[model samples]
Target: MALVEQLNRDMKQAMKNKEKDRLAVIRMVKASMQNESIKLGNKNLSEDEELTVLSKELKQRKDSLQEFKEAGRDDLVDKLETEIDIIESYMPRQLTDEELEQVVKATIREVNASSKQDMGKVMSTIMPKVKGKADGARINKLVQKHLS
Candidate 1:
């Protein structure tokens, strides 16, 4: 089933099961996906597009968790972390550090990049492969380490 359809089915199941937290996260995902679909002037979103939406939502949760932690608001941080886990359930398995390192090395070699000056080229080439599987900040760090 499509992401939206899957979300709809899950929403009904959550309601029946009285799963408050799961329902909330699923509702948020539905709203975000609908908003993106409308923004793009389309009625349906491809699986890849849905993944992009989920990725953005997960990133927002991560940012919120970081800010909450920095401000010493453990309560909110705890809630955001829960939501992050819920959101990530719909995403593909994340790449391991070793796997990410391998890709970065191969990408750098493909782009013939030996310095920071070629960072953009290497990143642009590799991001599509890594987008939903790994965090961009991690990728940047690995790229820098390999380049220098």
Candidate 2:
């Protein structure tokens, strides 16, 4: 099913289950999608666009989670963690370490990436292939390790 449809179904389920937090997250995701669509001349977002939005939302939550952890704000940390989990649920299945490593290695060769100086070349070439399948930091570390 499409992202919007899935969100709609989950929203209804959350409402019926009286899951306020989950429902709120779902509504927020849906709103973000709608806003993006509106930004693009009111056209529906493509699958890639949906993934981009979901990834952005997940990244924001994760960044906040990290900051809240440093600040010793347990309450906000818990909330951000929950939101991250919810956002992640909408993302594509992530690549395992082995799988991601393989892709990174292959792309490194594909781009003729040699030293750390070529990190940008490898990253730009690999990111589109991995997209939502892998976290960029993980890929960067893997690429660095292999290049070393």
Candidate 3:
């Protein structure tokens, strides 16, 4: 089934089970996905597009977790972690570090990125390959390390 259809079914199940937190997170994801469809001026989003939405949601929660920790708000940090868990449930399994390294190396070669100045070239080529599986910032760091 398509992601939207799966999400619709899950939402109904959540409502039936009275899973408040899970239902709220799923509803937020649905809203985000709808907003993206509106922006794209399209009636349907591909699986890749849906993954992008889930990835963005997970990233936001991670950032919030960091900020909450920095502020010493353990309660908020825990909440953000829970949110991250819920959001990540919709994403594909993440790439292992070794797998990510291999992908970055292959991308560097494909792009013919030979110098640090070619970082941008390498990143743009690698991102889509790693999207939803690896964090963008981690990809950038790995690219920089390899290129340097």
Candidate 4:
């Protein structure tokens, strides 16, 4: 099923099960997707676009979790961790280190990225291929490692 359709179905299930925390996270995700759709003039988002939205939400939750940890708010940290886990269920399986390195190597070869100066070129070429499957920071580090 499409991401939006899956979200709707899961939302209903959450409501049926009276999972308040899970339901709240689902609603937040749906709202963010709708906002992105509105920003794009109300067009239905493609799967890639939906994944982008999901990834953005996950990133926000992770950042919040980090801040909460630093501030010693274990309660909020746990809540955010739950939300992050819920969001992650909808994302593509993350790439393993070996897989990521292979992709980076292939991209480096494809783009003829010889040094750090070609990091931008290599990243631009590889990101679309790995989008929603790998973290940008991780990809950047791998790219830098290969290039340098």
Off by over 4 Å in 1: none
Off by over 4 Å in 4: none
8-90 in candidate 4: lDDT tens per residue?
A: 99999999999999999999999999999999986799888898999999999888999999999999999999999999999
Model 3 agreement with the true structure over 42-109: per-residue lDDT tens digits: 97888899998888888888888888899999998877787788888788889999999999999889
RMSD of each: 1.0, 1.2, 1.3, 1.0
Worst 10 residues of 1 by lDDT: 1-10
Candidate 4 Cα deviation (angstroms), residue 46:
0.6
Pick by TM-score: which candidate is best? 4
Candidate 2 deviant stretches above 4 angstroms: none
Write out the backbone clash pairs for model 3: none
TM-score of candidate 2 versus the correct structure, residues matched by position:
0.95
The residue pairs found clashing in candidate 2 are none
- The lDDT per prediction is 0.92, 0.91, 0.88, 0.92
Candidate 1 Cα lDDT to native = 0.92
Error of 3 at 101 (Å): 0.8
Query: In model 4, how large is the Cα lDDT of residue 32?
Result: 95
Q: What is candidate 1's TM-score against the reference?
A: 0.96
Q: Rank the candidates by TM-score, best first.
A: 4, 1, 2, 3
Tens digits of per-residue lDDT for model 2 on 34-121? 8988888757899988998898889888888899999999999999888888888889999999999899999988989999999999
True-vs-predicted CA distance for residue 43, candidate 1, Å: 0.9
Better of 1 and 3 by TM-score: 1
Using TM-score as the yardstick, the better of models 2 and 4 is 4
Per-residue error (Å), model 2, residue 132? 0.9
